[model samples]
Target chain A: MKNLARYIITRLLLTIPMVFILLSIVFVVLRVMPGDPVSSMLGGHAPERVIEQKKEELGLNRPLSIQYLDYLWQICRLDLGESMVFKQRVTKAIAEKLPATIELTIFGILITLFLGVFLGAYAADRRRTVQDYVIRLYGIVVYCIPVYWMGLMLQLIFGIWLDILPISGRTSPRVFASTFEKTGLYIIDTILVRDFSALGDVLIHLVLPAFTLGLVLSGIFVRLTRANMLDVLRADYIIAAEARGIRHKKIVYKHALKNAFIPILTMMGLQIALLMAGAVLTETTFSWPGMGRLLLERIYLRDYPTIQGVIIMIALIVAMASLVVDIIYAIVDPRVRY
Target chain B: MATILEIEDLSVHFPIHIGTVRAVEDVSLNLEEGEVMGLVGESGCGKTTLGFSILRLLRPPGRIVKGRILYHGQDIVQMSEKEILSLRGRKIAMIFQDPLTSLNPLFRIDQQFIETLLTHEKGLHKRAAFTRAGNMLESLGISPERLLEYPHQMSGGMRQRIMIGMGLILSPDLLIADEPTTSLDVIVEAQFLDLLNDLRKQFNLTIILITHNLGNVAQLADRITVMYGGTIAEVGEANAIFDNPLHPYTQGLLSSIPNIKLDKPKLKTMPGSPPDLVNPPSGCVFHPRCPYAKDICKVQKPETFSKDGRLVSCWLYG
Candidate 1:
C-alpha cells in the first residue's frame, strides 16, 4: 500500500511538468500564428474601435509575457477563459462537446477489446491454418483503411442506401432536448428519462460512426492480442497447464489470455488518447458535435484561447489515461506498484 | 514384469526451414508398472522428445511420424484429442528441468494448484480446490500460507518441490520427470532426488527419469535405456548397464564419467558429437562417434540382438 501511494504520487508529480510543457507549447504556437485573435474573430467588417475594445477585453492589450502568465494562472485554476467563437467559457464549451467523443471512444475500445482478444485467441489456436491466414489478412485490411472513408462508406450503406440508421448528429433535434436533462451522454440520459424511443434514435445515429471507428481500431487489437497470445501459449506454464489435463478453453482463457492481457492493457491507455485525437477526423466525417469538431470550428474563427484550451484539455486527458493505465497495470501485475 | 507403457517403433520428426530433423527414430522400449526407468543421453539426442511423446505433449512442427505409445495396450498416438487431454497430468504427469520456467510466473502457487485440480475435475469448488492445494503444499514442507505466493517468490528447489506437489496432487499413474533436478545445486539436487525416491514409493508411481547423468540413474532407476542419435543403443537392468555396457555408445557414455572408484589419470571424454538427424550416417548413427566402428558399421544399420535378458543394437555385439 505504501509502495502504491508512493508510485501514484511520483506519477502525478511527473505529470504536472509534462502537462505544463504541453500547455506552454500550445499557448506559444497559437499566439505566434499569422493572425491576431481579435482581428480574425471580429473580421474586417468590425469597426477599429470595436476591435480595440475586444482586444482589451481579451487581455491582448497586455504585454505578451503578462498575457502568457495570466493564461497559465487561469488554466491552473481549471479556467479555460472564454471562447470568442461560442461567446461562452472555453471550459463550458469543451464540457458540452466532450461527452460525444467519449461515447464514440467507449464504443470503439469495447469493440477493440472484445474482438482483439477473441480473434487473437482463435488465430493462435488455429495457427498456420486457413482460418489464421484469413484473420491475418482481415486484420491487415482493417488496419490500413482510412477511418473517415470507412465512416462515409458505412453512412452510405447503412444510412442512405438501406435507410436503416441515422447518418449524422447525436440525436434528432426534437429528442435532443429530452436527453440533455439527465447526463450529457445521450444514451445514458435517454435511459434515465425512460425515453425509449429517443434512446433508439440515439443508438441508430451512433451505429455507423461507432462501427467505422471500432472496426478500424479492432485491427490493432487483433494483431497485438494474436502476437501476445501466441507468445504466452508457448510459455512453459502454458505447457505445464496443458500437461495438467486442464481443458483447452480453461488454459487459453484463464491462463494464457490473462497473461496476454497485460501488454494490451498497457497499450490501451495511449490508444484511448490517440482515439480522442482520431475523433477529429471521425466526427468531421459524420458531423458529430464533439470537441474535435468544435476545435476545428474555433481554429477557423481563430479563437486562440479556445484552441489552446482544447489542446491543453486533450493533453490533460492523455495524462489522466496514462495514470489510469499505470493504476490498472499495478492492479493486474502488482509488481508495477514497487 | 507387468508392462505399463510399450513404445513401439516410435519416431518424432521436426520439420525446419532446411529439412526435417528426425529427432526420435525407430525406438522400442517397454516400461513396467511402478518402476524407475532411466533414459540417458547427451543433449539434442531426443531423450526429451521421447519423454514428451509418452504424454503426447510434443508441440507442432515436431510430430510423431510412425509410433505406438501403448498405455495399457491402448495406443496413445491413436487416441482422440479428448482421450489425450484426459490422459496428460491426470493419468501421466510431467515435471520439466527448469522449475522457474515450468511454473507460471504470473500465478500464485495456490492459484496454479487449485486451477489444475478444478480443470481436470469440473464442479470442484474454488474453496475445496484451495483447501486441497494448501494441504498438498503443507505436506511438501511449504507452509499453507505460502500457497498465495507467486512461483518466483520461492527458491528453485522450493519451486521444484511445488512442481512435485502439483504432479502428485491428482495421483497420476505415471510421472515423466525430465531432468527435474538439473537446475538445483548439488546439495539441493541430492535432497530433491531423495524426496523423489520417497515420493515414488509412497505413490507407487511409474517414473521415467530422463537424464544424462549416469550417477542419478544408478541412484534411482531400476532399469536403463541408453539413447544415441534418436535411437535406443542399449536397454537392460540398471546393474548390467553399469557393470557391463554392451553397445559402443553406452560403453563410451559409461567411460566418459570420471569413476572415483579407480583414480583415473585423466577424465575420459567422447571424441565426436552426436550425429545430425537430417542426414545421419548411412549405417549406424553412432558410427562416426563410435571408436569400434568397422567397415560394416559404416554401411549397414545394425539389428538388435537379445542375450541374457538384455538388448543391444550394435554390429560388434552381433
Candidate 2:
C-alpha cells in the first residue's frame, strides 16, 4: 500500500508541469491568433471607441507578458473568467452544461461496455465459429457508418417514422418544468425525484443520440476486447487452467476475461478522450448542449474565450483520465509498479 | 508393478498443404507406477510430439491418427472433453519444454500457483489452496515469499523449479517432462535434473523424461528408448542399452559420444540427415545411413524382437 501510494504521488507530481504547459500553450495560441474577439462577438462594424473599450474590458489591451501572467494567475486560482458568447461566468457555464455532457458520455460508455464486453467474451467462447464471424461482421458494419449519420437515421426511423421517441430536446413538453431548473442534467433531475414518467421520456429522448455516439465506440471496444481475450486464451496459464479441468465458463470469465480486460481498461480511458472529441458531431446532430457542439459554434463566432475555455477543459480532462488509467493499471497488476 | 500409462500403435501425422507428414509412426511404450522412463531421441525425432500426444495437447493439423493412450485401463482417446479434463491435471500433468514461456508473464507467482491448485481441486477453499501452494513451493526449495513475485523476477532455474513444483503439487499419476531443462545453462540443467529425480522419489512420482541428451538418460532413467525417424530404434534397461546398443542407428548414436581415449580420432557421426517425414525412406527408416544396409533392409521394415531381455527393431534381432 505504501508503494502504491508512493507511485501515485510520483506520477501526480510529474503531471503538474505537464498540465501547466498544456494550459499555457492553449492560452497563448488563442491570444496570438489574428481575431478581433470584441468585434466578432458584437459586430465587425462596431465603432473604434466601443471596440477599444471592449478590448480593455477583456484585458486584451495589456502587454503580452502581462496578459500571460494574468492568464496563469487566473488558471492557478481556478478563475476561468467568463464565456464571451454566453456572457456568463466560465465556471457557471460549465457547471450548468458540463453535467449534461458528462451524463451523456457516461451512458454512451456504459452501453459500449456492457454490449462490447459481452460480445467479445461471447465471440472468444465460440472462436472461429459462425457466431464469431457474425459478431465481427456486426462490429464492422456499425463501425464504418458515421456517428452523425447514424444519429439522424435513428432519429428518422425511431422518432419520426415510428413515433416511439422524442425527436429533439431532453424531456417531454407536457412536463411543464421550466428549462431554467438548474439540475444541469435533465435525466438525473427526473430520476432523483422518482419521476418514472419523466425518466422514461428522458431515456426515450436519449436513445437516438446515445446510440449514435456509442455505436462506433462499441465496435472499438469489442475489437479490443476480442483481441485481448484471444491473447489471454493463448497465454500459458490459461492453457494450464484448461489442463486442470477448471470448468469452461470459469476458465473463460475468471481466468481469461479479467486478465484480458487489464489492457482494455487502459484503452477505454484513451477512448473516453477520443469520444469527447467525437461528441461534437453527436451534439450537433441531436442539438444536445455540450462542450463539443459549443466549441464548434464558438469557433465560428470567434468567441475566443469560450473556445479557449473548452479546449483547456478538454485537455485537462484527457490528462486526468490518462492519469487515472495509469493508476488503475498499477492497481490491476502490481507487477507494473516500479 | 501396475501399468499406469500404455501407448500402443501410436502414430501422430501432421497434414501440410503439399502432403501429410508422419511425425510419430507406430511407436509403443508402457509405464508402470512409480517408474521413471526416459525417451531419448535426436531433435525432430518426435519426442515432444509423443509427449503432447499423451496429454492430448496436439492441436490442429497435427493429430494422433491411430493410437490407444490407455491411462490406467481406460483409453484416453475415447474420453470426452469433460472426462479428459478431469484426468488431465489430476492423473497426467505435463511440465512443458520452455519454463520461461510456459508461465504467464502477466500474473504473479501466487496468482498462477493458487489458480493451478484451485483448478484441479474444485471447491477447495482459497486460503487452504494458497497454503498448499506455499507448502509446495517450499518443498521445491523455493522461498514462499517468492510467490509474491512475477515470472520475470525469477531466474531460469527458479522458474524451472516452479514448473516442477506446479506439476508435482497435484501428485498426478504420470508427469511428462518434455525437455524441461533444454533452455537452461549446463550447471542449472544438471541441478534441475537432480532436483527432478529427488522430487520424483520423494513424491513417488511416475516420470516420462523426454530429451535429446543421451547423457541425461544415462544419469536418471531406469529404462531408455532411442527414437529415430518417428520410430523406436531401441528400448532397454538404461545400463544394458548404454552398454550393448543393438540397432545400427543406436550403435551410431552411442558411438558418437566422445570417449576419453587419447589415441581415438574424432567421434564418428551418422552420415546422412534425418529422413524427411513427408517422404520417408522405405523399409527401415535408417536404411540410407546404415553402413550394414542390405537388399532386404531397403525393402522390408524390421519387426520388434527380443534379444538379451531388450527390444531392438532391427533385422539382426528379427
Candidate 3:
C-alpha cells in the first residue's frame, strides 16, 4: 500500500512538467498565429492609434518575454484572465460550460464502453462466423464515417423525420425555464430537485448527440477489445480454466475478459482525450452549451485567453485520467508495480 | 485391474486452409486403474493432442473427428457440454506443459484453486474451499500463506506443484500431465517428479504422463506407449520396452537417449524430422525415416502385431 501511494505521488509529480510543456506550447501557438485580439475585436476598421491604445491597455504591447512570464504567473495563481470576446472572466465562462461537456463526455464514455466491450466479446466468441463478420464491418463503417455527418444524419432521422427527439440544444425551453440551475448539469440538478419530468427531458435531448459521439468512438474500442479478447481466449490459462470444469460463461468473463480488460482500460484513457476532441464537433452540430461550443465561439472571436484556458483544462484532465488508469492497472495486474 | 479409460479409433484433426493436419489418427489405447502410463513421442507427434482429447479440451480448429473416449463405460465423446463439465476436474483433470502459462497471471493462487473447487463441488462455501486449497498446497510443500500470492510470485516448480494440487483437489479418477516438468530446471524437475510420485500413490491417481523425454517416465510409468507421426509405434511394459524395443522407431528412440556411463557416448539422431501431419507419408508414416523400410513398408500401412504380450506396429514384425 505504501509503495502504491508513492507510485501515485511520483506519477502525479511527473505530470506537472508535462502540463508546463503543454501550457508553453499553447502559449506559443496562440501568439505565433497570424492574428491579434485587438484588430479582430475592432473588426479591422479601427484607426492605428486607437488599435495601439487598445493593445497597450490589454498589455499586448509589452515585450514577448514579459508577456510570456506574466501569462505563466497568472496561470500559476489560477487566474485565466478576462475573455476579450465575452468581456467576462475566462475561468467563470469555463466553469459555466465545463459541466455540460463533462456530462456529455460521461454519457459518451458509458455508451462507448457498453457497445465496445459487449460487441467485441460477442464477435470474439463467435469468430469467423457471420456475426463476427457483421460486427467487424460495423466497426469499420462506423469508424470511417465522419462524426458531424453522422450527427446530422441522426438529427434528420430522429429529430426531423420522427420528431420524437430534440434536434438542437441541451433541454427544451420550457424545462430550461422552470428548472433551477444548481450544477449547470441538467440531469443532476433535476434529480437533486426531484423533477423526474425534467430529468426525462434532459435525457431525451442528450440521446442524439451523445450517441453520435459514442458510436464513432465505439468502432476503435470494438476492434481493440475483439483483438485483445481473441488473444486472451487463446491463452493457456483459458484452456486450463476449461480443463478445470469451470463453466464456459465464467471462464470467458472471469478468466479471459478480466485479462483482456487491462488493455481496454488503457485504451479508454486515450479515448477520453479523443472524446474531448470529438465533443467540439458534436457540441457545434447540436449547439449544446458546453466547453467545446464555447471554445469554438471564442476561436471565431479570437478570445486567446479562453482558448488557452480550455486547452489547459483538457490537457490536465487527460493527464489525470492517464494517471488514474496507470494506478488502476497496477492494482489489477499484480506483476505491475511502481 | 479395471479399465479406467479406453480410447477407440480416436482421430483428432486440425483443418486449416491448406489441409487437415491429422494430429492424432486411428489411435487406440487403454489405461488400467491406479496405473501410470507414459505417453512418449517427439514434438508434433500428437502426444499432447491425445492428452487434450481425453478431456475434450481441444480448441478449434483442432477437434475430435471420430472417436470414442470411454471412461468407466461412459463415452466422453458422446457426452453433452454439461456432462463434460461435470466429468472434467471432478472425474478427469489435466496439468498442462508450461507451468508459467498454465496458471492465470492475474488471480491469486488461492482464487484459482477455490474457483476450481467451487465450480465442481456445488454448495461448497468459499471459506471452506479456500481452506481446502490451502491444505492441498501444504501437502505439496508450499506454504498456505503463499496462496494469496499470484502465479508470477512463485517459481516455475512451485507453480507446477500448485497445478498438480488443483488437479487433485477434486480427486479425479484420471489425470493427464502433459510435459509437466518441461519448463523446470534439472534439479527442480527431479523434485517435481518425486512429489508427483508421492501424490500419485497417496491419491491412487491414474496419470497419463506425456513427454518426449523418455527419462522422465522411466522410473514412474508402469506401461509405456510410444507414438510417432500421429500413430502409435509401440506399447509394452516399461521394463520390457526398455530392455528390448521391438519397433525400429522405439529402438531409435531408446538409442537416442544418451548413456552417461559411456565416457564419450555416440548419440545417434534419427535421419529425418517427424512427418508433417498435413500430408503424412502414405503406408507406414515412419517409412521415409525408418532405416529398415521395404517396398511393402512404403505401399501398405503396418498392422499392430502382438509379440510376447506387447503391441508393435512395424512391417518388420510381420
Candidate 2 residues lying further than 4 Å off, grouped into runs, are A1-7, A13-36, A43-70, A121-126, A161-167, A175-192, B106-114, B143-153, B259-267, B296-300
lDDT of 1 by residue, B150-204 (tens): 8868899999999989999999979999999898999999999999998898899
lDDT of each prediction vs. the true structure? 0.87, 0.82, 0.91
Better of 1 and 2 by lDDT: 1
Candidate order by lDDT, decreasing, is 3, 1, 2
Of 1 and 3, the candidate ranking higher by TM-score: 3
Q: Using alpha carbons, what is the TM-score of model 2? A: 0.89
Candidates in order, TM-scores: namely: 0.96, 0.89, 0.98
TM-score of chain A of each: 0.93, 0.89, 0.96
Give the lowest summed-lDDT range of ten residues in model 3 chain A. Answer: A172-181
Best DockQ goes to which candidate?
Answer: 3
lDDT of 1 by residue, A1-338 (tens): 89878887888898878878988887788777777777777777899899889888877888989988988898789788887655798888888888888888788778777887789778987899999998888888989988898898888898889998888998876775543455578888888878899889888888877888888888888898899999999988888888888888888887888889899998787687768767888899989988889889888778888888888778777788878887888777744546
Off by over 4 Å in 1: A45-50, B259-265
Worst 10 residues of 1 chain A by lDDT: A174-183
